[model samples]
Target: MAEKEPPGTTVVIHGGNYGPSSQQVVCPNCHNRVYTVVKAEVSRRTHIIVILLCVFLCWPCALIPYCIDSCKNKNHYCPSCGSYLGTYYN
Candidate 1:
């Protein structure tokens, strides 16, 4: 089920989407700057395993995880208030 937001709350979603670039983005919830990159849909351990596979198993095979949105979606979160902005799907 999808989670619902409370009434009268606004979250600004910018077309300000990008890849894994080192940049600061506007935080809708905090109304200030925040680190844009958040975790992928995959868990931390899963990401580590993927990284290990990319290093050990095969080079090109690493694209499998990198191409998957569940593993690559860049979630944007507010640094000040700890809120979500949006997900950047590559």
Candidate 2:
């Protein structure tokens, strides 16, 4: 069964399977097969890396740089291939 979030409450999805469940496709920018989350621990580690990078860079610039893009959608998609890049949370 799927999980649920309460109304007017914030929740964090620790890890889950996402993206196209088929052969990997190349990223337009990097031209690399996107990595899949085979293990929840691995995904958590990657999430930490991204958050740390954003905090290090954006925190110096401003407190909420990621929020600019996140306000629209949770995950940002590529206009060219329509691939799920990642979520934008600030």
Best by lDDT: 1
TM-score of predicted model 1?
0.44
Collision pairs in model 2: none
CA lDDT, every model vs. true structure: 0.63, 0.41
- Residue 56 lDDT (model 2): 75
Task: Note the residue pairs that clash in candidate 1.
Answer: none
For every model in order, what is the number of clashing pairs?
0, 0
Model 1 regions lying over 4 Å from their true place: 1-13, 43-70
Please, what are the lDDT tens digits per residue for candidate 2 over residues 1-90? 986867865332223323322223345455555442221122343445557767778545343333333223244344445655554333
The positional error of residue 21 in candidate 1, measured at the CA in angstroms, is 3.4
